[model samples]
Target chain A: GDKVKQSPSALSLQEGTNSALRCNFSIAATTVQWFLQNPRGSLINLFYLVPGTKENGRLKSAFDSKESYSTLHIRDAQLEDSGTYFCAAEEGQGGRALIFGTGTTVSVSP
Target chain B: NAGVIQTPRHKVTGKGQEATLWCEPISGHSAVFWYRQTIVQGLEFLTYFRNQAPIDDSGMPKERFSAQMPNQSHSTLKIQSTQPQDSAVYLCASSLQGEDEQYFGPGTRLTVL
Candidate 1:
């Protein structure tokens, strides 16, 4: 079984709309990180959370360790947001490699 | 500050040849990680080093894949006897000692023919 799984393998949104992406962890994830892999193949870090929630501009992310799940909410989607969103979970603590989800492909159309 | 740096950016190797990928972690970071990404596999962890010491390599293929971090600033992933199946985008990442937030490099695309 996959240690990390993402829902809605692909999503299409209109500009100014809102959408949510999710990650479910089978491992005992201690922290979660969200990244957007742009069309150019560079991964831009979006959020790094250890429980609770974090908001950055139009992006908000929440990580619930107890439930072993995380959510990334995008408000007012823009064309630049069209890319692959990946959620990675780190098990235990320091020096551990992250287990990445399959990722959700997002396409924001004008 | 510059994020993680992966060298070559792209590489082409014939089957049975060898290929080496390089990664320069962010300054002051103590942990370095390596991953391989493909359309079929998504992203898979290969190995990781903390302060130049290998912590885990459970995800690495036992046969021809190897990784080394000789110093705090740089690490390398070497693939001996490369095969077409070994082609993928190799990514390097780094994070602080106790923090789980990792910064990634642009990645090196390895193509085996």
Candidate 2:
């Protein structure tokens, strides 16, 4: 079983629409981080969550350690939102490197 | 400042040949990570370095994969014998801390024939 399992392996949305992405953890996660891999292949850090919720612009993310889950919400999806979204989680403080889940590919069209 | 830098955006090698990929992390970043991305497996952690030392290479294949961080700025991943299965995009990323939101460089695509 995967330590971190991300749902909605792929998603398609219309411009100005909204959607949600999720990640379920098999291990107890202490913190979670979300990233956006744009079409140019650049990974931009979207949010760093610590068992709570965070929102920036049209993007919002939440992490629940007790529930072992995290979510990314997109509002007013734009063409530029088409790319891959990845979530990584760490369990403890002992050199606990991040374990990433399979990314969710998002495509927004007209 | 220029973020992470990686050379040779595209690489092609023959079967059984050796391939080396280079990455230069952001200045003053203490942690660097390597990952291999494929359509099927998505992004797989390959190896990483912390404070110019190997932190964990458990994700790397013991037989043919080796990685080293010679200095604070640069790290290299070497494969002893390349195979078709090794053809994937190798991505490099760096973060101020060993575990956090890492900044990534544009991946280097490797093709084997």
Candidate 3:
């Protein structure tokens, strides 16, 4: 039983298309952070949310703490977007610690 | 800033040996975190420190694993009696505060034989 669960263990999309990744938390999450692990295995920060929505360029993210879930949407996906997406949640008064999801491996093909 | 710096990008050790990994957080950052990544486990949290003091290490194995932040700038993770199952990439991250967005290092790949 994972504290944080990610949907669609794998995803494949065509370049210029769109796709969404999701995370569901069993813990009382106060904040959520999303990361993209590139092919070279570097984890890049994507978004950090506190029960709201944030948009950065072609990427949009939403976090609903009450519902214990978060979503990351990629618009006009590009080849550089091909990587593993991970979501981490900070639990109730968890202090700086985070519980991580298994991650979604996304492949964008041109 | 240099993001977070991890030393010994890769390490190989025999079973029952010891391994020590180091991390240097961004200047002035107050928090540091350690995580391990593998195909099966994905990214797993191991420990965290705030202002050079350990805040949480609930994710760490009860035996043979330890972490320490001697100062605000750096931290170290040590494992004794390393096993092959310990082979994975270890990542270090830093944030200005406990709840802020974290910046990660490239990670150190460990192979235990």
Candidate 4:
């Protein structure tokens, strides 16, 4: 089974609109990190959460370990938000590597 | 900070040739990781080193692929007998020791024809 599953494989948003991306983990993830991969193929770190929620500018993210799921909410989408959003989960502790989801491709336009 | 640095932003190689990719981790970061991304595979972990030591390499191919971090600042991923299947973007990331948040590099695109 896929350790991490991401929903809405593709998404489209209009400027000023809002959208949310999700990830469900089959593994017992202790930590989760969100990343935005731009068109240039560079991954920009977005959020790193243990539990609860975090808000940064127009982006907000929540991680619920009990439910084994996480969500990334984007408010007032802008063209720069167009990219692939990926969520990676780290199992257990101690220098372990992250297992990434397939990712959600997002496109924003005017 | 300059973040992580990767050499040969793009490389095109012939099949059966050798390809060497380089990575320079952020200063003071002890954990460095390698990953491969392709249209078909999305993202796959290759290996990771902590403090110049390989902690895990379970994701690396058993043959033809090797990664080494001889020092804390730089690491290398070498592919012997490269194949078209090796075409993908190789990404390097580093983080503070034992931290979950990893900052990624711009990635090195390898094309084997």
Candidate 5:
């Protein structure tokens, strides 16, 4: 089984609507990070978490290590937000290596 | 600036040929990571290096894949006897440690024919 799993392999949302992406971890993740890869193949780090929630602009993310899961929420989806979303999990204690999930391709229709 | 740099935004190689990808990490970053993204598997971790030394290469293929960081400024990933299935986007990222955000470069997209 994959250590990290992402829901909704692809998403289509209308601009100004809300959408959410989720990641479930089977491994005992010590940390989690979410990233967005633009169409140009440039990946931007969105959030780094350690069992908590954080929000930036219209994006919100949460990580729960005890249950082994993470979620990324997008509010007021915009065309500029359309991209592939990926979440990576790190399980080994004090280790920085990450196991990436199969990304979710998101497209915001205007 | 404040980002990782990768050269040769794209490359094409023939079957059984060799290819090399380069990455320049941000100054002062101690840890560097390499990942491969494909349409089928999405993002896959390849290896990681810290302080110019390999820390984990378990994700790399045992046959034709090798990576090295001879200096703090940059690193290289080499593939010998490339196959068509090896085509994918190779991304390089750098971070200070487990705490800082990992900065990624505009990946090098490889096409093997």
Candidate 6:
């Protein structure tokens, strides 16, 4: 079984629409980080959370350690948002390497 | 801050050859990590260093894979007698300490044929 699992392996969105990606963790994750891998293959950090929610511009993320899940919400999706979204979780505590989910491929079309 | 930097964005090598990938962490970060991504495996953690000291490498293959952080500024992952299966995008990341937001490099794409 995967330690971190992401839902809807792939997604297709229309411009100006909204979508949400989810991650379920089998491990007792202490922290969660969301990243967007652009077409150029560079990972852009979107959010880092610990059992809380954060909003940045058109993006918002929430992590629930107790429930062992995390969510990333994209509002007003744009073509630039087309990429693979990955969520990684850190188990236990300090210095632990992150365990990444398979990732959700997103394509926003106009 | 220049963020994490990885050299040789793309490399092609014949099987049985050697490949050395370099990573320079953020100026003040103390923890560095290495990961590999492949179409079949998605993403896998290879190793990690804290304060320039090897902390965990459980994910690294014992045989041909080796990593070192000789100083705070840089680290290197060397693969000996590389095989076709070794082809993947090697990513380097850095964090403030052991548990913080990690910033990743552009990644080094290694192809062994």
* DockQ of every candidate: 0.74, 0.64, 0.70, 0.82, 0.67, 0.90
Minimum summed lDDT over a 10-residue window in model 6 chain B is located at B95-104
Q: lDDT, candidate 1, residue B51? A: 85
Q: Candidate 5 clashing pairs?
A: none
Which tens-of-lDDT digit does each residue in A47-71 have in candidate 4?
9999889999999999999999999
Residue A110 in candidate 1 has what lDDT? Answer: 99
Candidate 5 chain A, run of 10 with poorest lDDT: A90-99
Off by over 4 Å in 2: none
TM-score of chain A considered alone, across all candidate predictions: 0.98, 0.95, 0.96, 0.97, 0.97, 0.98
Q: Between the candidate structures 2 and 4, which one is better when assessed by lDDT?
A: 4
What is the DockQ score, from 0 to 1, of model 1?
0.74
Better of 3 and 5 by TM-score: 3
**Model 1 bad stretches (over 4 Å):** none
| Weakest lDDT window of 10 consecutive positions for candidate 2 chain A | A90-99
- The CAPRI category of model 5 is medium
Instruction: Provide the global lDDT of candidate 1 against the true structure.
Output: 0.94
Q: Residue by residue across B1-113, what tens digits does model 3's lDDT show?
A: 67899988999999999999999999988999999999888788899999888888988999999999887778999999999999999999998887777889999999999
Deviating ranges (above 4 Å) for candidate 4: none
lDDT of 6 at A10: 99
Tens-digit lDDT track of model 6 for B12-84 = 9999999999999999999999999999999899999999999999999999999999999999999999999
Tell me the TM-score of chain B in each candidate.
Answer: 0.98, 0.97, 0.98, 0.98, 0.96, 0.98
Q: Sort by DockQ, best first: what order?
A: 6, 4, 1, 3, 5, 2
Q: Report the Cα lDDT for residue A72, model 4.
A: 99
Model 5, which residues run further than 4 Å from truth? B98-100
Per-candidate clash tally: 0, 0, 0, 0, 0, 0
